[model samples]
Target chain A: MGDSNVTRRSGKNQLLDLYLTFAKIGATTIGGGYAMLPVLQDEIVTKRGWATESEIMDYYAIGQCTPGIIAVNTSTFIGYRKAGILGGVLATLGFVTPSIIIITIIAFFLQNFAEYPVVQHAFNGIRACVCVLILDAVLKLGKKALTDYRCVLIFVAVLAAALFTPLSPVLFVILAGVAGVILMPRKKPEKTGDEKASDAGGKEGTS
Target chain B: MILLRLFWEFFKTGLFAVGGGLATLPFLYDMSARTGWFTTEEIADLLAVSESTPGAIGINMSTYAGVHTFGVIGGIIATLGLICPSIIVIIIISNVLKKFQDSKLVQKIFYGLRPASLGLIGAAGLGVAKIALLKTDVFQESGVLAQLFDWKCIILAVCIFFVYRKLKHSPIFYILAAAAVGIIFKL
Candidate 1:
């Protein structure tokens, strides 16, 4: 009974710590979740040592599959890993609170204020800049994604389909997923003794 | 009845909108087609406003749709409904995550998901490109080239690209700069 109580208390404390950490992440990180990647990496991996780099990458991957926001999904998974359901709840709430407050305030003014000429002009300019930001994200993500020939082919096919055909984006995504499953190279079996010996000899001089 | 229906509709949207907030676009477009609660033009406008605002695009669009459909109450219902799944799933996953943390199958599932997510992001990039580069009814109709291409937008895109590359500045800086240019150029 005493041990169980200690466990519960420790879990609660961990939840609180996770909430505070995520709240700081939400408040300070600018330019949305993608920009928050390095900070999340630093806090979760480098500092806390909660998850490794590959594990964080896995979170990013699964986060994309699920709904809401990538950052929220990541935070939820990490927080949950650390504590439990309560921790996940607290972490998500902390992440979204800022966005909620900001949006509500903007919504209040948006209807009437968006009509103003200056405001309209400002939005136009912002829209233009947003195109740049989106493009930058694409370029960066593309370099990471399109490392091999298969990925490059998929990229080209998707781009061509998007540009030329009236294909639905959703359909395209499903197709690409199918293609990835079908086309991704299988891991090869371990080489025979001779090949292993040659590989070791090749590496010996370089090292 | 109305509130329940509103909640269910948003719940469905949230459940299916994989990839991210922008993936909600096609679903919302389908909703507009079916219901006519809102027009395509309004949907486009909603996309613009939602993307520009300071919240998750999915939530903002849900709020817009809810407000359009059933006013303030609808907005709250829709928001709650949309978020419900995430809350529930996260809670459940949180409970079981530790046991499955090192599972190979789970790892492989996420590995497959990375490419899928990249594909969706690519598709979204294309959608935004269509809005940014293509001149629709927003510009006057003329020849095919004139109808499709907006030189002004292209110029702005190029300028912003170079500025972003050289300065490596924040998005807010670009937003402010673009606002200034819009006022000066009347674009």
Candidate 2:
């Protein structure tokens, strides 16, 4: 069961190294999920050799599809591959350490000074910018998600339902997933099978 | 007791906020409506804070929300609650379902989930737009149609959007510039 011979470091050191490396990645990455990819490629794939490029891509695809934060999920997958459960746990802990530390400090100051007029003005501007950011995110995601008429229909339906009803967003997600599973299979038997294959190849296979 | 509720609330958020960091916005909006722990305007601030910070926006947001509610300990609990699902789910997939990503079932679910996630995000975006771009409280008070709109913010948002379409700068730069505009123009 002892496979530490492949790496120069001892088992304990390897786990610690995994933690510290992810901590650095977490501490430095200023953006969101995809932004961390290049850093992961450099640190984990190239520098550490913990995972191959293709393997990293695979983790990212699965990570994006699954629940929770994409960055944290990718770290867990890589850490699990490198060491085991403990390694995965440590890597996740390391990745979140900087966030908790940094945000806690900032949150403290923000709470205390939020009443100041200068701070309020700054937040007012920042809030406007934040709206633009969200709209941009929606635009980017729409390009990927609304690939076809049916997908667009789903998007519209979901939007209407979510906005009009008091039903939980979670219900819509689950229902849409169920719709996908049921609806996608029907397209397979039609002449559109080739198109389905290509779409799947592009979206699911490579992503 | 409140700590448990916070953990449970965020745990649900982490589990269902499926697409990415901003996908969590819908859930956060729901939480604000339900709990009254933070206002809708505060969520826009949280987004700005999360975006400017050096970490996953999702983690930064949960930490900020937690700290707002119950201080450092609450931040810890909320963060732990958020990551708990990731650790367990990732470990399970790695151990048992090595080929999970390639499965047809998983692909189909993602196919449906993505668009729905987009809808949620778009809806959340509109919610924020109401707070940031519209002066609803002023409109209510003044009973004037002109007072319904914050022309400065609307102009700023339009300018920022067009500039972003052409230039494609980092979000931090836009945020900093917007803040400067707010300060100088008192927007």
Best by lDDT: 2
List of chain B TM-scores, one per candidate: 0.66, 0.59
**After superposition, candidate 1 runs with Cα above 4 Å error:** A1-87, A94-99, A102-115, A162-178, A187-207, B1-9, B16-48, B65-77, B90-112, B138-140, B144-149
lDDT of 2 by residue, A154-198 (tens): 789988997789776667877888887876645453334345445
> TM-score of the candidate numbered 1?
0.64
Checking candidate 1 for backbone clashes, the offending pairs are A125-B178
lDDT minimum window of 10 residues, candidate 1 chain B: B104-113
lDDT of each: 0.62, 0.77
Q: After superposition, how far is residue B138 of candidate 2 from its true place, in Å?
A: 1.8
How far off is each candidate at the interface, as Cα RMSD in Å? 5.1, 5.8
Docking class of 2: acceptable
Q: How far is candidate 2 from the true structure (C-alpha RMSD, Å)?
A: 7.6
Per-candidate TM equals 0.64, 0.62
After superposing candidate 2 on the true structure, give the runs of residues whose Cα lies further than 4 Å from its correct spot: A1-99, A106-111, A185-207, B1-78, B93-98
DockQ, each predicted model: 0.29, 0.42
> Which tens-of-lDDT digit does each residue in B36-154 have in candidate 2?
88899989988877866668999999999999899999999998988889888889888755676566776676567667766765766777677789999999899999989999999
Q: What is the lDDT of residue A41 in candidate 1?
A: 47
